[model samples]
Every structure is written in structure tokens, then in C-alpha cells.
Target: MKARRVLVALAMMAAALPVAATAETLTNDMVVALVQAGLGDDAVIAKIRASAGHYALSTDDLIALKKRGVPGPVIAAMIESGSQGAVSAKAAFSADSPDPLAPHPSGLYLLSGPRMVRIDPTTSNQSKTGGILGYAFTGGIASLSIKAVIPNVTARVRTKHGRPTFYFYFDEATRGLSQAGSPSLWLSGPASAITSPNEFTLIRFDVKKDRRETRVGSMNLAGAKAGVMDRDRIAFDYEQVTPGVFKVMPKADLTAGEYGFLYSVSAGAGPGMWGNGTGSARIFDFAVHP
Candidate 1:
């Protein structure tokens, strides 16, 4: 009987070993730090470490990580490459670097800076395009309006089994047609499948353009429509662009003027806003310029 009891105890201990071996011994402080650090899930850590590599991180690095839900400072500290750091920092400082689109933080922002003048580039949760998106610009003296149909661009998504839950990406680039001389939305919200939204939103930025101190302009647009179902957004902006286009210098060439900018847009809610649509805003010809 005693021998039989010993054998049973041994079997129970063996059964418990697997659970103990597989368990991850993480401390509370460690878990908290990881979360506060924006470690998110285990997969997030791997992706951050992988793409970040040995590169040193900066504000742009943090912005890139923001798209990934990682902590900004942590990402900034992790960048190991100078080129990557510069690239990411540029994104961080430029308002044009992002626009609203699909599942995640999809909100359109139209901005113009020295050398980097990108047009409507859509930011979305994923790739699901069915209709139009909007763009607004803030300039020194001009209020511009823009509209066009969103084209479905390929998006990067994470899957559980085979189902894609989240997507992140930029839209296809749009070409500039003849410039409209007045403040207007060149196109209504998205109208074409393979094209970019029109450039209709604008704000005159010349009020404070010449000041050595940084200047800002704001734009507000509202009551527009998003191409997807139930997608709604209200976009506001403040901008200041140097006068010497394409010149990245400490002293900005403002054409010597006192300028102020205002641009804004409000679109009804759509599927693109909350994963209700088939695709998301990738990016567009969203622009800010001279």
C-alpha cells in the first residue's frame, strides 16, 4: 500500500511539472513597466525589436511606434541608425505625415513644411476603400478645399488564425491637376476608385510667415462625407511654412510677411472610421504648399 501511494505521488508531481516549466515568471513591476513602456503584447515586443534593430530612436521613431501602439519615449531610445532617426524625426515634426483612414487613429491632417510637401496621404486602420475622403490646407492667405475617391491600397494587417483584426498603411499617391485659383474643394469627397481625393481645403499662412519665431495657422472644415459607412471626422490644423520652398535652413525665408492659417473639415461618420467598411484610407494627394 505504501509503495502504491509513493507511485501516485510521483505521478502527480510529474503532472505538475509541465505547468511549472511553461509558466512565465514575470514580476508585477516588470509587467507594469512593459505596459507603460507600450510593450503591448508579446508580438509587439518582437516587432519593435525587429524593425527597430540596432537603430537609435527619436520623435519620428516614436511616431512610427505610435502607429504600432508602442510607447513613444521607449521607441525613441531604441533607434540605432542615424538615417532612421532623421527620417522618423522628420515625420514627427511634419503635420502632413499623417491623415485619417481606417481602423486605428484615422484622422486627416494637412500640413506643409520646408522640403517635404506631400499631398493627400490617407491614414487608415486597414485597406478597405469604397468611397471618398477629405483634405483641408492651412496657408498664409489661401483657404483651400480638396476631395477625391479613395483607392484601396494594400495594408499590413495582423491576423488571428486567418482573420485580420487590425490594419495600418498609407494610400496610393495622387497627381496634381491644374490648381484651383480660389479656396475650394476641387473634388467632393472620394468619387473614384483608383484616384486620389481633390485638393479643395486651404488657409492663408502669410500672417506671421516672416517672424523668426515659429508661426502657426489654423483651418477648420466641416459637414463633409467620408466614402465608407458611418465614418465621421472633424479635422483642424495650425501651420507655418517658410517662404523659400524646398530650402531647409535655420532661417526661414518667409517672403517677409505677417500671416495666419486656418483649415478645417468635418465629415459624417463612415465605415472607414470604425472598421465598418471594406477598406481604409491609405494616403492621398493631401497637400500644403506655396
Candidate 2:
């Protein structure tokens, strides 16, 4: 009788165990298989929701899903499900609470810096195209000026995982171009001097559908002392934390997407504000992982 009781107890325990304990974790291939097996988005999402395991997704995984005719919303559901093992997206970034990824002023340097290190031609083989301008005064009566500039270039960098604040460190070289004089001086100074903290704006870069990009929001400088800022333009709040160190605080948590900073020549009044460049902007691209 005692032996029979022990056997029954063991059998009950086994029955209570979840079947998924022996099942494989979720994967892109598994999702594809399910879709091919005629499962709908609702069904797929339900399975993922009921499943228990971390989903390790890669760039290839996303591309594969798109290629396999998976709807973007469905793919987004998969990513959200994977990103938050159990927590919801809203819970992940609560509006009332301080962002867990918020950087400490002292610790900002550890995670923030210039993504594009201006390369010296002597140090690297990176091809560069740009030159200086010249002005000639003939007979001290009339003057001839020559202008030359390269097309805007982009730099790609990955965002520090989970960090919401962006830090920009200006070495002596960057400050001379962007910082130094007051905002009023920007118009009269060299084009290089057009780079101000307010000149920075966040943008979204879509890799799919012809690699198009768009501005994230319409931001403007509110508390600036001097500058030609438009309320209609997208801008960021900038502060000089130290001599050459600056931090840009976004209005809200950045959603999972590909984003970048645009350095606009029309950062002040508007297009052709500087009367130099054609209001073209330099972009520094980055990705926010889910």
C-alpha cells in the first residue's frame, strides 16, 4: 500500500508540469513555420504570449520575417513580446517615473561621446571631400569670393543600450566649430561655426522601403538666450554640463526604432539663414534595440 501511494504522488507531480518545459523556445524559424502552417497573426501572438522563454532576435531574423510576407504589425508584436518577457511596453517606459536608463551627470561620460571621430587623413584611408573658401579684394574696391564645401556625410553608431539621454563631448576641435561665440555670431562666422547645440535634432531612419528617413518630431529651442530658432522646427534641449561637454535631453523615451541626430544649417532663423549652405544637414545614424 505504501509503495502504491508513493507512485501515485509522483504521477500527479508529472501531470502538473507544463508541456512547454520540454518544448523549444520561440524563434523566427518557428514563427515562419507556424505561419506556413496557416496560423493567423492573432494565433501566432497568442502562442508567443503563452510561451515562456527569451527570444534572441537578430537583424537577419527581422529581414527574414519581412521577406516571408509577415506583416509589420505582426513582426512588431513578436519584437515586443521578445523585448518584454512579461512586462508591457508602457510598463517598460512609464511616463511618471524617472527612466531607469537615465544617465547620472557624473556617469554620462562613460556612455556618451562623439559617434563620428573626425579622422585625420594621415591616420586613415577614409576618403574625404571638402575644401576652404577664399576671398580676393581687387584694388581695394571690389571683392571676389570663392566658396567650396563637400556634400553632407553620415556616421553610423549604435545607441548605448537602455540609455535615454544623449551626451555630446566636444573636444577642443568640436567646440571651436559649434560652441565658442554667442548664437548671434553664428551667421557671420565660418560655416563650421554653424554647429550649435540647438542645431541637433533627432530623426528616424527606415532601412526598409528605399532606406528613407524622417524627422522624429517638431522641436524648438525654448529657453535659449540668442539664436534664430523656429517653433516649427525639430530641435533638442541642450546644456553645457562642463567646458566642452554637453547633454541633449529628449522630450520622452525613445521607442524601439532606428534614429539619428541631424545637424542642420537652418538651426537658427530658417533655410538659407546662414546664406552659405543649401540647408543640408549632417546625419549621425543609430539604432535602438528592442
Candidate 3:
């Protein structure tokens, strides 16, 4: 009897809510109230999905929601709702903004002043697969390493900033602009294949007099694979600007040298084992000038 009365009062209150409040505005407090009013997880989740959920889902926020007796499933639904909302909001903002960081061609870009400078894709001219000597010296115990040698000592695209910011757009439209006339190559299928920035590596090339080199991967005598060595890899941080869009920045300031964003598709061997039934590799090369 009391539960019936509570439900009736809640319905009346909802009816009295302003159009904006009654429409797409579902808040954390309202969710707690609904759960307290004896709503099931499905009911709460349905409400969340139907409304624009303004949920504070930080660690502390989640903990508070759990403490308030919100069901685990409801919490999970809240998270999904929050993620969808964020992506939608980001897409809307990107679509409206005239900023250089807004959605553009699907490729790597460096932000220079008010303009976005596209980084052209290039392939390694030569590959040196060594570590065989090391393996022999170690009695087939050491791993075999492969280094990709790009023909030019210097890259055409140069930036004065030591730690430049880069943007990546993986939209299906304008996919050919970044692939160096090979759109069917890297990430051809689903745009979701390379969702995270971790899929790409920031590599500082070993600048020789005539070429720049970096270790792509290594393989053991037994065909076990060890991906790109840590020595040549530079750490970076990234955040999703919108769906299929990301902003990347190096964790530490890069020293003036040749660098590139390297993405490779491994074909059973190791990364960058291009040609001869191996796989393919793509790099967006640039130089950080002092």
C-alpha cells in the first residue's frame, strides 16, 4: 500500500517537471531516487537509455552510486550511457567547430599555428633483418631483430616544436589522403580496428648519414615474435576527440631528430615484415628541428 502511494507521488512529481527536465535530462540523483523507489535494474537502465544521462561516473561517483544500492547492471548501463553520450557530444562539437582540430581527412596531422599540416605516408626502402649473428653467438638463444631503413636522412615535413601535438582521423571518408595512394592497405576494413592510440608507436629513428633506421620487430629461431624494441619506441599519451578521431602527444619532450608514427600489420611473422608473404608497414615521418 505504501509502495503504491510512493509510486503515485513519484509519477505526479515527474509530471510536474519542466519539459526540459522531463525530456532528455536524467541525472544521477534521479537515478538513485528511481532505484530507491523500488525500480528494477531493467527499468532503471531503460530510463537511462531513453534519457540524456548526466551521470558523474568518476571512480568516486561510481562508488557513491554503488553505496546508494544501485544494482551492478544498472551501474554498467550507466557507464555505457555515459560513453555514448560523450561520443555523441564530441561528434556534435567537432561537426560544429571550425577549429583545425576538427574532423578532417583520415590521416596523421601536426598542428602548426592555426593550420593542420598533413604528414605524408612513406614506406621503408630497405629492411635489414639481423640478430642472426647474435642468435648464432648465443647458440640460437638470442632473438632476431629486423630494422626498417627509410632512404632519406631527413624527412620532408619538419617541425620546430620538440613536442608537437598530432591528430588522427580514421573516418571512412578521405581515407586515401593519408595512405600514400594505397587506401586499401592499412585499416581497410572496419574503422574500429585501430581504435586506441597505443596501436600506433612513436619511434625516433637512428639517423645515419644517408638514412634513418628503427627496429620494427624481432623473431626467435623458433619463430616466436618479439615486437618493436623499447629502445626505439617513445611513449605517448592520447585522448579521443571524437569517434574515429584522436589527439596524440608525446609523454616526454622529443630531442630534435627524425621521428615517425609507425603502424604495421603483422602477418604471422612480426611487425613490418613487408613483402615476401610477410606483412606491410606504414609510417608518417617528420623531423623535430632544434
Candidate 4:
């Protein structure tokens, strides 16, 4: 019924879902396959192959993964490993983490035309301002990406007049994420374009966690838009869809450019994870560009 309760229910469902794999139970074939595919390292592959337990993976979309860099060896190992597997088979983050409404500063984003402006493994190093929590820096599994869709961008690009027609447009949500802890299209472009003062809007879904003690209620990601959007950035109050997972989107325009707008998710001891000497927050950044 309530938003928090609904999120908790969804989390329960997630945990109830059958895990696809366990370490030590993977086969050598699975290992080599991932390495060839460029997903994980050799050491990771070997460990996964030697892992234990039944793998929950289905048909194992080897070819499909190749396009996303699942690497034959990595996917195989993931199929063998479980949620704790070293290979970031999938991403896990929630907007309810530290400073749920943390804003992504504005800047300029550059985009290479005809390119999807997708955030790949190469965009991992981008950063704006750092956060005090474990997620302070721009590093995390980018599961989603949203940009402000500014109008008249095409006209400015073609005209010699340096018009401010660049609009920050994301796919209504974090469109760059690949479901895995990697670069998404939204966070892989020019950092300056997305974080600029008047470029993109940073929306953070603010989900209430301390609703009178008994952590209850939940919300849905569907139809959920950014909390606030301006010519520059959009901010969303934290919305809890479930633990280890979060989602948000844009409500305004996003200009075109090549930049990396990343999300910081801290499930462990990375940057921005530490809080007021209490609970820790997972920080992750999904990069994207126009």
C-alpha cells in the first residue's frame, strides 16, 4: 500500500527470486567464454569455475552478452557465482542511500554524433564533485541514466551562432545503465555538459526510510518522474523501490553533448559509503551523454 511498504515487498520478491549461480560450481568452458568475451579477469574466471552450488542462470545468453562485454569467461563465471560474485553481472543500488537528494552538479557534455553516447567500461573514471559518503566520487555501477532534453539543440549545432540551444535530454529515466555495475549511456558523455550550472537537471527520488520506526511501506519506479527539473539540473527525493536497487528519471529537457553523468552506489567500502557513524549507503554513478 504505502510507498516504503511496497518497496520492501519488492525487495522481498527480489530475494525470493531464484539466484542464478554459485561460486565453485562453474565449468572451465564458462570461464574461457567470459575471458574471450572481455567481462572479467582470468583470476576471477578461475575462481568462479571452482565455485560451489547450483547455477541459477538460464539458457546463458553468451552471444547477447558479447555486445555488452559480458565476456564468455565472465558470464560463465557469473552463471556459476551468485549475487556476491566478483563479476558485476548486474548492478545494485538505491536512491535512498546517503543524502538521498544529492545533486549532480551541472556542466558541459560532448557527444560524438551518430554514436549512441553510451557509457561503456571506458567511462568509469569521470567525476564531478565528490561526496562525503562512500559514494563521494563518481564511481559505481551505472544502472540508469536521465538527462534534460533541451530544445533547439539541432539548430545551434548547425548554425555558427553559439546559441544556448543545447538541451539535456535523457530517456525520461537513467537510460545509460546496462543493469550491470558499468557505464550507462547517460553518464558516458562529456562531464562538463551534464554537470554545468544550466545544462542538466539532477533528480533524486527521496524515499522515506524512518517512517515512524517500523521500516514499512514501498513505492514503484513506474511513472515516477524527477522531483524537480530546471534549465540546469533536476533533483528527486529518494524513492525506495527496494534494497540494493534504485531508479529515477528526468522531467525537463537535456542538451546534447559528450559527457559522463555517473551515479555513486555504495553497497560496500567504496567512496561515500560511510555515514554518520551509523548505517552505510551504497553509491553508484551511471554515466551518459547527449
lDDT tens digits by residue: candidate 1, 1-290: 99999999999999999987774433223333566675556644444444433332445645655665545444433443334544554343332232222111112222222222223333333222211232322322332222322223221211111110111111221121112121222233542221211122221121222211111112224332333111212122222221111111112222322111112223325643323332233333221122
Expressed as tens digits, the lDDT of each residue in 96-148 for candidate 4 is 22322221111112233321122221211211222223232323321122222
Rank by lDDT (best first): 3, 2, 4, 1
Comparing 2 with 3 on TM-score, the higher-scoring candidate is 3
Tens digit of lDDT per residue, candidate 2, span 1-290? 99999999999889878763577677777777887788888998788777654554678878878898776766887887765653443233221222323221111122334232211111111111112221122332232221112222322434555444555543322321222121322234233454345655565544434243342222112211112124323345677665544666666566666656545323223453223322333444555664
Winning model by lDDT: 3
Query: What tens-digit string does per-residue lDDT give for candidate 3 at 1-290?
Result: 99999999999888887754656678889999999999788898898888777888889999999999998999999999887765554444332233644546456778776677778778765676677788888876798777777878999988888889887767543331232233422355432476566788789888888988887777665765545677767999998777667789999899998999887634435443444424445688999997
* Candidate models: Cα lDDT each: 0.30, 0.45, 0.73, 0.32
TM accuracy, model 1? 0.15
Model 2 TM-score (2 dp): 0.31
- Estimate TM-scores for all models: 0.15, 0.31, 0.55, 0.18
* lDDT score at residue 278, model 3, on the 0-100 scale: 41
Best by TM-score: 3
RMSD of each candidate relative to the true structure: 23.2, 19.6, 13.2, 24.2
Which whole-number lDDT from 0 to 100 does residue 64 have in model 1?
53
Sort all candidates by TM-score, best to worst: 3, 2, 4, 1
RMSD of 3: 13.2
